[model samples]
Target: MTSTFPILTPAGVRRILLDRKEIALIDVREEDPFAQSHPLWAANFPLSKLELDAWPRIPRRDTPVVVYGEHDGVDLAPRAAQVLRALGYTSVHLLEGGLAGWIAAGGETFRDVNVASKSFGELVESKRHTPSLSAQEVQVLLDAHADAVVVDARRFDEYQTMSIPTATNVPGAELVLRVRELAPDPATRVIVNCAGRTRSIIGAQSLVNAGLPNPVAALRNGTIGWTLAGQKLDRGASRRAPADVTAINRARAQSGARDIAAKAGVRRIAYAELASLDAPGRTVYRFDVRTPDEFAAGHFPGFVSAPGGQLVQETDHNAPVRGARIVLADDDGVRADMSASWLAQMGWEVWVVDPVDAGLRSETGTVGHPAPEAEAVATITPGTLAGWLNDPKENDVAVLDVTASANYVKRHIPGAWFVIRAQLQQALEKIPSARRYVLTCGTSQLARFAAADLKRLTQAEVAVLEGGTQAWIEAKLPLEEGETRLAVPRSDRYRRPYEGTDNATEAMQAYLDWEFGLIAQLERDGTHFFNVV
Candidate 1:
């Protein structure tokens, strides 16, 4: 009889390693055994941490996971595989002979590698190598007339509570995207700091890796370290102009108001025009860009809640229509206008509509209780879906599996690609343009977001698999079993590394020249493909 399960040998594991497959070689031995040695990159998800943190970080569900442990009559691999399979991972496999087999096979073992220690070490090494100036040093630099810019890499709340008087808060993740906005000058020294060290280390290293012309450094050990060294720490938030109102407006002006306005290409459409564009066969999205609480308070029927900033940042993920007309509803125009401006810059077709103007009831009717807007993007109905499934055309069909990787592995709609909702935008290129796409998730909420976003970004014919995968199974549709491979987009590779005070005019001009030319150099060296994220 043919065996239903496969036991992977050390040779098989080696092949996976060479190919860089996403296989986790788990050592299920007790703490004492694990403390002796483990494979490189092999994290000890100790049987203890298994149910808690280990399962969450396993990037893919269908991944060929290999488990091993001590041999002496103790077969932990089998039990581990069973648990993983119970967790809905369909492809759990046991290492042929556990750690003993690996040793006999002459496999290498790593000593003294733990996640926490490695992370801390990386933090320390980064600080030791990167340049940094203390508060006193910064004062001295100012006294000596040296050109430098200081930036605070902390959350907005922390920045508001306390920060260096001369530093500006540019949150860590936003640093790369907003770097050019912060420092236009290349000649000025760029200094980064956080409350302690980790953020500063990572932030400073980011600039260094990005090949910034200006010298970048962390404020050694950050604010605490500086204060401990008999130096002063600036308290109370810096009195700076609001970023949204002042900085954004200034940036718009510099980019050229006429040019920006032209690029925005905003058109005010009447309710009649909006209705004219709506068709039975076409997918349309109506968004209420307001807080969730406000949306729950009262909103137009059929409108879904997607806050303005998040909607813009995740436009490609939330609304994928490249040229899909978007109608945004908000009681006030400020939030809508701001969101529309950013969306336009990112190459989206967007329109802001006043909820009251569209014959919608006033939210004032409800005092305490609120509900999600009654308006939802018109989606495919079960009858229409059944009809499509019966005669599904190759040209007008696409299927997206939005379930977690593990769930998708156990069973999913045939031909549906596993698309992580968070990474949907980056996976756009992998999606085919030939057919209408159908999105399925554990529930309909994520499916709606996926379907709406896909329709908007790709402008491809789209539909949500009614009732998601659950309904698909209930209808007895054919199911396919396989592991899902994540699609990573080219744009997702580019990461920003610097966040500092606005550079001096001379430094700004110099840096711009360097950056413009570096792209060509990177391409010539054939190393431009490297990206942080």
Candidate 2:
């Protein structure tokens, strides 16, 4: 049966991209499968967590949203469309014939997470000719204990996970701000690395753009290249950049950041001008480029926490609104100014707000917008659901665990059917008859999205389990293991060959080859307006 939502051909979507129209090309498949192949502009909008992620990812409900799935019998695009319509999305359509149609229409597809930004990073390096030192050369420098410091541009946890010997956790945004403290002497060399190529390249180029006195270079290919070359990585290392940034260093960072930002054409907006950016119907993302700890200590109200380095590395994950205006804020002006430089080069209309006003709030803790309200649905407590399971009167009560198949196989309520939330209606036909159905997931947030769908499909008394599987575990409940009761296969999360040390050498090499080929793909697509100073 054809969907009432019009079918958008791949050529039509391609034209939209070429014409630079605002579009949300959404792929409703799980991340892993979607990573294997997708249009360059398509963002993953998995069916399972549509309610939670869609509002922020696709801000304008009326934005042209073209959704696609595998086109197999189990495709989730149709179900996803229903959910989007329910969520009040005004304009929604499906990609005709799904991903296959895109390939058939000569649309370029990309692999790996954040492919767009990764390719752009490669372009930046190619254009600016970022400097780098290979693993062998870096090892020689480390052996000699030269006047050089290696800065891990990744998050602290990743540095803790694995790092080069004597590397400090400067993160990405901190590099430009704290480099003077780490390597005070102008002659000291600075080296930066991430798990892979992008952060290292960006970090090195940042200092070059800032006109820092020290010689800077990215550790070629980052940790992956090091491991491939048989260099030993230190695990559980916890060295951090110096805590107190000197006043002289602060002034230097600010001056340098301002100069670089000016060259990149980044903007600065005062609080009053920011008011217009906040008016309704405009898509503006405010980010505090400070560290999580700093933001928690005090930050402007309504700003999301996106530490500078990680924001540059994970632009797709943090800000999916490509054409949306972005405003970055920081107290010292160094962090936000430096970060805004990169974002501006990446084609974002970015602004840096000098955050010295009385409006800065000291609300200490994690900050985020309140989640959009979910539809009204009946729910049962974990303890109550347990009682219902044991009751003789309700012996026919059935459980549908809407978590990923991988999680289900790890631990699940005994006799619970592992299902994809959006596929609940189709799965119900094959499930055993029940007087009532209880839906659950890791936290039950996604279960709410499935509750109405289940009720509509089964017409049976459907209710979500409060607190989900986690709440059940807290109740000292027993769990079943194995892949015995599954309505959905585990295909959501991609297992990157480059991520862990356990992958076969061939697979890792293949991953590197794929990354190397992205430059050509970018040329073929030719839409990303990436510039490097």
Candidate 3:
């Protein structure tokens, strides 16, 4: 039976990309499989998370979207397209032949996530010859107590997990503004590093671009390189940049960042321009590029928080839609300008929102957009579920957790079985039948959809945990840890070689080799509109 939804060839998608139009090339498979191989610009929008993620990720209903997926002979693309249509998305199409079709058409595929931004980082280094110091050289400097400071450009949590000796955490966006405080002397050498190469290169180049007086360099290949060079990394280190920036340093940083942003062709937009950019056909993403705590304190009404450093490191995950217009906001002048400079160079039509009255940032607390609603599903409070679980014989119930597999392994209800929502029916075949079933995830939102799905698959009674696993923990309920019972394989997240202390030497070297070759890959692909200023 041939399908009814409109079909797009790999060539058609490429044409749209070349034309610089808005097109979402979505891979509707779990991240593990999608990370194995995907077209250069394809964003993973798993079928299991389609309803929960679609609205926020692809906000414009009529934006051209091409979905493709296949796992264990299960064709998920058509199903994903249908779900998009039901969510009020008017322009949804399936990629002809899916991943296989793209390969057959000679389309370039990339391994690992965020290849677009990672490759761009390599391109930036190639074009600019970004300065860097090998782990061994940096180690020599540290051993000699030279006039140098190592700034880890990753998130604080990553720094805490593993860091270079005598390194301080000053995430990428803060490098230009905070480096002065970290190394007060203009002659001090500043070394920036991350788990791997991208953030390290970008962080170092940012200072160079800002024309910082200090001599700066990235730690070549970051911690991975350190490990490869037989150097030890410090664990549980909490060194950080000072909280306060000197007025003079702040002024210099602001001027420098703005100059670089202008060089990269980033526009400074007034708040009123947001409405025009967000007009019907256009998809505009408004983001607050400050720290998470700063964003939680206050933010623009329509903007969500995306820390500037992580935003650049994970542009594909943050924006997804190629060619979408992005507006970044920050109370301080430097962060947003610095972040926008990189986005502009990445070929996005990016703008930094001009400073507004403090009164405009009145919204308090972290941004958490609830997934769009589906038909009402019955709900059970965490307390009520606890009572039922205490004596299961009479209650005759089964609990299914639909959260990420990794999260499920960390903590979950004492006896709930981990299951993939997309494989719910197949998983049902393995679980013993029960009179009643309860579903849960990180929040009850995803579980609510899963409950509705379960109701259709069986005649059994179905309900969602009122507040999901978080609420269960808050209720002081007993919890189980580790992969207790799994009805489906854990294929949700792809483990990156750059993460954690335990990884094969071979894998780390392979990851580095892959990144080393990305500049050539970018040229062969030819869709990236990157320009290094």
Model 1 — which ten-residue stretch has the worst lDDT?
489-498
Ranking of all predicted structures according to lDDT, beginning with the best and ending with the worst: 3, 2, 1
Compose the digit string of candidate 3's lDDT tens values, residues 418-527. 99998899889888888989999998888988888889899989999998999999989999999898998888889899999999999999999999999888888999
User: Which sections of candidate 1 miss by over 4 Å?
Assistant: 1-14, 26-40, 43-56, 68-78, 94-149, 152-169, 179-188, 194-202, 205-215, 220-533
**lDDT tens digits, residues 33-72, model 2?**
8888887777887887888888766766777788888634
- In angstroms, give how far residue 369 of model 2 lies from its true place: 4.3
How do all models score by TM-score?
0.36, 0.90, 0.97
The per-residue C-alpha lDDT of model 2 at residue 22 equals 62
Q: How does candidate 1 score on lDDT?
A: 0.54
Candidate 3 versus the native: TM-score? 0.97
lDDT of 1 by residue, 31-113 (tens): 44564655533445444224333333352456566777753365656655655675666676777767778768776653332
Per-model RMSD to reference: 20.8, 3.0, 1.5
Off by over 4 Å in 2: 1-3, 6-9, 278-282, 362-364, 368-375, 387-399, 404-418, 425-436, 457-461, 473-487
Candidate 3 has which clashing residue pairs, if any? none
- Cα-lDDT of candidate 3: 0.92
lDDT agreement with native, every candidate: 0.54, 0.83, 0.92
Error of 2 at 68 (Å): 2.2
